[model samples]
Target: MSLSAATLRSLKHHNYRLWAGADLVSVTGTWMQVLGVNWLILSKTGSAASVGLSLVLQALPTLLLGLWGGALADRLPSRPVVLATQVAHAVLAAVLASVAMSDPASMTPVYGLVLASGVVSAIGGPALGRFGAEVVPREDLPNALALGSVINSGGRILGMSLAGMLLPFTGAGGLFLLNAVSFFAVIASILAMRASEMHRLVHAGENSGSVRAGLAYVLRTPRLLVLLALALVLGSLGRNYQVTMAAMSAGPLDAGAGGYGLLSTVFAIGTVAGGVIAAGRPRLTIGLLLGAALLTSVAQSVSGLMPGMAAFAALILPIAAGAVIIDTTVGTRVQLDSPGDMRGRVIAVQGVVSAAAGAVGGPLLGWLCDELGPRLTLEAAGAATVAATLVAAAALARLSNVRLDRAVLLPVRGILRRAPAEQAAALP
Candidate 1:
């Protein structure tokens, strides 16, 4: 098969096609809502801190409920659970639109709606995370997830672009209204799916459904424990580029908002490109995951050393690409290795990682940027990620005898070569 064919093989399954297409629409609208809400907060309060707080409110639910959310994914039927969440999302969007339109002065209702939406996300995210197993076979899952990264990257670009163009005329309320409509796409798609065609995921047993059990599972599994540590470190330090990017624009680069926006656009392009390339991979391995992790962390360090804005922008492409590949690779490995009963909870830990990044890393990184400046701050983040990756490599080496070259380089070589689907290199 051609590379395009391989990348899109998951879409040949009827259910996944509908789900993915709808997800693209919903994701686009979700980004619009995000930009709209942030704009609304800033316009109302004229304080960047207030805007930051709004983000915290949106992510807080995941920290509080992520484990339970994953447990719910294991216990409940995805059709009903996903359907209900989509509808709740629609309602929340509509309410946000209403509040933005009717009472622009009241920040309380806006904050409340954001928190409620976060609650729904925290609960639904894990089910959504592992939903691909039901739609596509295990063999095609890696492609499905890589394609999802594409959808996400594309959606952010499209949604933010649309919101930027429409916001002046429609206001934040308009973007929210648009997002409200977008949810229907996913809801209808879910209802239309043929449940009979869905595959059963690998289940550990009835006794393995609790949140505590999920945590215990990760704690006991060497590969999983290493991955969890990698996620926390990489996610917190390596992935918080938004703050670092802005600081570079305003501080040493002195390029202002336009430069920040340009860098963001470039990063999005990189992710889209990376996701497309990653979609053609035949399998996910511990090797590919660690390689991508190393590439990302190391590239991050090199990017910090770039003296000019142009050089930095160029470097961010691989940084973003590596980040997406790492995400797709890690999520795929986690899902493949985990039993169905434990899958949601394991995936839900990713949410906890994200929340911790936002709560702990965001503030800490921000302080670093303020005190030490963006250049030094980026180096610190890069150093932190490099150290974490090395420690993880050492742990894996001890547990599984993972060799650096075989585990890291071979898979990356396969990726670069786009090895024939049947001939793709599979490494430890």
Candidate 2:
């Protein structure tokens, strides 16, 4: 297939097209809110630690209930679950907008609203993943996932730029309201999709045991374990870009808000490029995932050492691209590898682990920024990610050796089948 055709294959499906459009809008709004909230906190408290606290509040729910949410997705129709979550998110956004308008001097209300939204996200995240899987044929899942990453990256670019432009006129309250409206776009699209056209899986029954089953499966699967391990390390140490980038721009670079926004835009451009490249790939593999993680970590480290804003901006391109490649490849692998009935649960497990990492890492990184400085913070995170990736590679190498031995034994077993049974046994 041509590059465009390969990258756009998932969009050929009517349902997937509708879903992608809705996702683009919703994700854009979400990114806007993220920037708005973080900026609002920084402006108020003038501390990266306060910004980190907000992120912790947003992620704590996922760490606590993400697995249960996944189990719920397995037991329920993804459409209704996703719809309910979207509605909840809209409501939360509206509440946040109202709070922002009220001009509370304290961070208490903002933290509470963020915590509530995080609760909804924890529950809806896995169901949303399953819903996306339903929209396209199995063969096109990787493409769909890559396209989803593209939307996420593109939305960040648009949202961050818009937030910067709008911050002066509308302030954070207006941005929150915009996000509230954006949720409806997704709700409408979900309503538009015909259930019959979706590649639905039967509900796995409403059993509490299902949650444990998902956890057990991940523990037992060597590849899944390795992937999750990599995610935990990278997510905790390196993925808190909102915190790191903000501090870097405002602190070390002395660039202020506009500069920070521009950096986000530059990074997002790289992510869009990475997503497009990932979409063109025919398949994903463990080796590819690990390699991407290593490259991303190395790039991040290099980005920290850049002497000027222009050079740092240039390095961020590869850093963001590498990160996107890792995310898309690992996400596609999770979807393709899991059993249909258990896919939601497996995804939830991943969400929980990642969220936990973020919760812990965000605060720690923020503190590091305060104590050591943004430059050292980025370098430390990159080093940690590199260490984690190497460990995962070593583990994967062991698994690869076992698989290779099995492959070699398979041909020997085949030769034995061609020989007389007694003679084959004697030769062995």
Highest-scoring model, TM-score: 1
Residue range 45-112, candidate 1, lDDT tens digits: 99988888888898999999999999888877766778888899999999999999985776989999
Q: Candidate 2 on 1-428: residue-level lDDT in tens?
A: 88789789999999999999999999889989998899889988999889878888888888898999988999888998998999999999999999888887998999999999999999999999999999999889988998999998888778878888998999999999999999999999989998788999666755533888888878889878887888888888877786788998998788899889898878778889889877876664555566567767877887788887899899888778777877877788787888888888888988887777777787788899999999988988898898887777767667666343222333234222533222211111
TM-scores, all models, native as reference: 0.95, 0.85
Candidate 1 wrongly placed segments (more than 4 Å) = 202-206, 409-427
Name the top lDDT candidate.
1
Error of 2 at 362 (Å): 2.9
Residue pairs in collision within model 2: none
Clashing pairs in 1: none
